[model samples]
Target chain A: MPQIAQIAETYASQIFWLLVTFGFVFFVIGLDMVPKIEATVGARDDKIAGDLATAKAAFARADEIEADYRKRDADARSSAQHLIAESKAKAAKETEAKIKATDAVVATKIAAAEAEIKAASTSAMAEIEAVAADAAREMVAKISGASVTPEAAQQAVKAALVHG
Target chain B: MHQFAIEPLFGTDHLAIGGYNIAFTNSALWMVATVVVLWIFMLGGMKRELVPGRWQAAVETMTGFISNLLTANVGPEGKRYVPYVFSLFMFILLANLLGLLPLGLVGLHPFTFTSHFTATGVLAIMSFAIVLIVGFYKHKLHFFSLFVPHGTPVPMIPFIFLIELVSFMVRPFSLGLRLFVAMTAGHVLLKVLAGFVINSTNAGAGFGLTVGLSSFALMIGISALEMLVAVIQAYVFALLTSLYINDAVNLH
Candidate 1:
């Protein structure tokens, strides 16, 4: 086996080069390259975590905004409802007051017309009595050829009207 | 055996220091190749995008795998050892896989440095040394208590301690030997099967049909298995190293 037989001759060379090359690898690759790769991986992880947190905050803000909008919408709707009800009540009250005033005016006009009719009826009865007295005086003169006074004729007509 | 032979890339005496021949060899070439491959692989992930491409994801998966392994084996304190363990794991894994690169089809032989005990022994020693340094630095002499079980009877303590001490001392050798032997055996088996296929085909058509075809099929299967072994060995080396570190850190 040359490996065993040639050891005395090759050991030095092998050891020398092994140390030189391995030393380069340890310093250049192990010490330097490894850390850089790990740093890149670490930075990527941090970015992902940060982005996730930002998304979570944004989502929460959106939910809050939606809730606020809904609340305001409900408030606006209720205020509109309150305004509608208030105006409806005010219009109804105004209508009732106008109807009451108009009702009182109409009642006064009707009473005045009734009093005027009663005065007209009283005058008409007086005129009819006078006409009846004159007619009676004429009729009595024609039938008996007696000349009677107007007041006596009126009295006779009033007695006959009382007996009838 | 020729595959494992380590010929100096330059002449043998080209580079020597302190009287030790440190000539650059094929094994050294593969070590450098492993580093280059690992660098390229790591470069793919350096794009540093928030959404990683496939290449970047592959690199991150490997690092994350090692990180998780340390966390599971060595607890929180295991974090400090990630670079060392990651380097060790990737180096060994790439070396093992590169050796099985099927470059033989192109007439290029890939050397598996990890198959050599000298290479694996060095890695095992490094891990063992860390364990020793961490244990003593943190616990002082109390690190010796690692040999004695927590609630041993006084009479049984000495015998148990001896067993534990020997096993503890065997860790580095076992760690190194396991990877070396596994890699060497698999390569040797594949080579021997290739030899059988060639020899059988040269012998005759009947032998070639029976032996050569079967050996070739088995070689293909073992090659697939070797790929799996390559990954498993690297994982085991890292896992055992982390577990050993766990002992030094937790004292259990």
Candidate 2:
């Protein structure tokens, strides 16, 4: 009963202190601490997000660089191949031209050698005709006991040679 | 027991001004002590490390717990009410736990502020006040529709509304009585059981020793339960506050 009665008597003081303490705690935590904690949490989250974005951007940039490098490498390889093909074609054309020039020079030499041989054979034949005519004239004078003319023998020889 | 008795700590001749007892009593001292402890705890835990230390973790855990409680009952819109809800939960929790600590001033009883109906009554009324004020402020006349059940028959509407009204009216008293009764009951039971051990120990030699030891063991068990009760009661108070606020905001 006294406990019940004392509640009313001390009600005002209890409330006053309660208000004072509660208000103090509320403001201290509500205005100060809670917001501070929230800010920290928000900041941590933002840091994580920013770091993740940076990482993603770096990854994308690396990919682009690699692609560019691959393209350049392919271009260099193709150009090298093209250069080899062109040089090979040019070398073949020069070899063909050299062979053609050599063949012309060889054909000219063959023609000159044939003409010299023909001239030499013609002179030999003429010498043989003169010797044959002299020998015939002497044989006739000695064996037949009639004096024949050298000019006539020569003409006869010419005629025989021409007919043969 | 004289544990519940209040006496003036300072200001001789029983400081009274305008018929109001303005004496700084043991209750006031304990209340101040509770507030100071809270202040130190909050201030000490103010360091916001990426990896929180023990003190910081404790503060964050407590803040998160209350945050979750509000969100669960009051939904996303209850974000603004965190400070008030956090204040009530921590106040009641600390008061309950502190009273159980066996720390008392010379010639004064160890007590909890939550064990007093005056304190819990004020807290409950304040929570209820927020509901009414915010509800009326938000919903205005439609706030009365909270008593009406949605899609009720015309005949049963009156009965349901009456029941709802009564339940609403009893919210503050129920809230106050729940904490007071729980704290007071547990404390009284602990006192009685401890008394049993003392009395039994004083009775005889061998038999007294046996009874005393067993009772002491039982008392320890009860003390553990009382600690759990302290936490639960704090949670329940905050949870109900959130629920009531939700009811007020989102009506029937």
Best by DockQ: 1
Residue clash pairs of candidate 2: none
lDDT of each: 0.90, 0.84
Per-residue lDDT for B1-252 in model 1, tens only? 999998778847668777777888888889889989999998998898888899989988888888889999999899888888988899899999999998989998899999999999999999999999999999999999999988999999999999999999999999999999999999999999999999999999999999999999999999999999999999999999999999999998
Pick the TM-score winner: 1
Steric collisions counted per model = 0, 0
Candidate 2: tens digits of C-alpha lDDT, residues B92-128: 8888898888655465477677778888899999999
lDDT of 1: 0.90
Q: Identify the leading candidate in terms of lDDT.
A: 1
Worst 10 residues of 1 chain A by lDDT: A122-131
